[model samples]
Target: MYDEIFETVVQITHHDYAGCIDKKGWDHPAYFREQIATRQLNDQSFEALMQDYLRDYQELHMGFRRLEQESQRDVGFTVRRYEDSLYVTSSQQEKRIQVGDRIVALDGETIEQAAKRHARELKASHHEREDWSGVLLDTSEVEVIASSGGGRTLALQAFTKLPHTPSYKIESVEDTLILTMTDFWNHDAITELIRHNEGRFQNAKKLIIDVRTNKGGSDLAYSELLPYLFKGSHVDLRDFGDKAYTLCTERNVDLRVELMDQVLQTIEDEKTRHQIDVMVRELKKNRGNGFVELDLSEIEDNMSFDTKQGPEEVVVLSDVFCGSSGDSFVETVKHSDKVTVIGRPTLGMNDYANVAMMTMEEKFQFWYPTSKSSAVDEGNGMGGVGIQPDVYIPWTPEHLDKDVDLERSMEVLENFTHKGSNI
Candidate 1:
């Protein structure tokens, strides 16, 4: 009877995998083969099976190769400094070249066409290697806008301050200090700024940490900064979800036991108390037996700020690029009373990812999740709906060019500050 059902289901479903229809038939491959053979498979069915198998095999192979490339790719970029003249280096290769002498073009056009033409001829002749070959051209418009040394310097400075540019100057308004971090991981300069202001937090009437352009980085660094803002509060900084198993810990057990004790003592109804007690005992048994300890003690100690403060006011600035550790930071901050998040919605990834190491013969590589992460809720996978802000502020091209978001944040802070004033 089971064999007939299995064959019927397979035929209807168009599945081609081989398996026994019953436990007794597992050892008899001939019987199993005969059962499958009873139903004659057509060309279309055979082709479908072959295509499905090939597709799955190819996908598995491609997945491994992608992981390999990600682990091996160079994660570094060139850094150029402008001294008396611009100097650029391909940091990985340690190749250095002077800009003015080599790069004779602004855009596609030449700064000195005759010099560039002659340089091209020399380059073609192989007098110098291509690694050191091309002239270093200024990508900015300042080169043309200011022909002289002083004018060029001023224009370059202004260009650096341009809103759309990669870097910007941080400014303070009233009690609010506006800092926009556009890159992943805090650099030495940013670290120093945080350190310098650590002691001054008490003086701040309100604090705003802006990361609208923050791409993301080390989760440890991002989350470690939270305690400082809170001062002191026994806040749960992390939560984990397991679908198949209930996670347990001494701390979780104690928490459950304490809650149960309270419920048993507080509820006057005998039947309800008895029912609650039984439920608690069953839950405790299941969790106590299965609980796995997660090492969050490290994070607890690493938090620089005291946890005594119940709540403080903080506003997190976010955008689509805020991900990974950035997502963790935003979620962690949302728990505090003092923290009121403002800006556009986040990318809504709340869980962490693991970077796995792989090897292909002699070459070693690693694979990381391009879009794989679990949230506190196991079902809330990566790319889930992101966190929405209390106040929604959209980005516009004009705002990008003029720092409109920063201005809006200031307005919010000003209104908040003035609302408390008796005047």
Candidate 2:
């Protein structure tokens, strides 16, 4: 099973035109074979080994999965690398651990040691992370400056914030509207949400669009949002850039066809269905013909949804969690004269997309990108550093309870003169 997994990934890595192309970090077939051969390998151990093998890539999109085990044991929150130090990013309320608190050590492992070992990958299984039981956490002691905990100790309960449930709402805060969406896959749901609440939006002068927890979904989901964001005097071209290149292989084509078949059957919208149909047709036409360029934008959906004229100013809130189509959303809205993204950088997985999956005898699966965007060579790649915010707000503990980003957005809209005021 291990050998098979390695070979499958190796084949895709060599053929797929993405970041791992020509990278020989994980090429020691015999070395890995010997290492795993000597170890008492289990599911978790194999996963760790594979993780280390692919650690060099550290890509948010490139990873492996299996019959979804609860791998992450939540000790109230997850820690992430901010500069050279590790800070608490997300925490459950009961834990009383503030977001942005600096942790000096976990399970006796110092921050420097853990950082060296894990690099950028901080998973539940790591030695520093909490187990099914728990681990000792030593927080930094400072003069209450931002994230210093002043040396505290507590046994945080094991919890799971995994398997995120989608949340969506449009709240009317006097004149300003707060649109918080955690999803983008349900087609024109956002469009419908806006249209249904048209009167509310029309009256509002400043709009705060929050996607801090929104991981992302289909691009079509935000189709209705384009017009509201457009600040240009002319039309919103919404150029998707040059054509994306997909490695034309039999397996790649077959997987795409299988995936698109579901799209054809599930999506009721005729135009969307047609566009997907066209993609699949193109896949079949160019299978095993080396790398081929796919221009899906050529076949237009021609959505005639009425662009809302209200919301003179728009502030988009994003986080590091926002990625894939989420990154696409941030990029797409940049063309809008009224849109100003304010938050942390995104997850940075937009360079290679249209993820396809391959299952190995239902035991495990390898999901990877099928195509590489022209943006890679065009100096617009989003593999490492994702879309940057117009107004950057560093993550702090005050944001644990309060929506600091939103407050900042409000501040920007009320006092700070923005370029969009004239638009």
TM-score of each: 0.44, 0.82
Please give the distance, in angstroms, between residue 336's alpha carbon in candidate 1 and its true position after superposition.
Answer: 1.9
Against the reference, the lDDT scores of all candidates come to: 0.41, 0.66
Count steric clashes of candidate 2. 1
* Candidate that scores best on lDDT: 2
lDDT score for residue 85 of model 1: 21
Candidate 1: 10-residue stretch with minimal lDDT? 15-24
* Runs in model 1 lying further than 4 Å from the true structure: 1-171, 183-192, 231-293, 303-312, 350-352, 357-365, 369-382, 420-423
Model 2 C-alpha RMSD vs. true structure (Å) is 5.1
The root-mean-square deviation over C-alpha atoms between each candidate and the true structure, in angstroms, is 19.1, 5.1
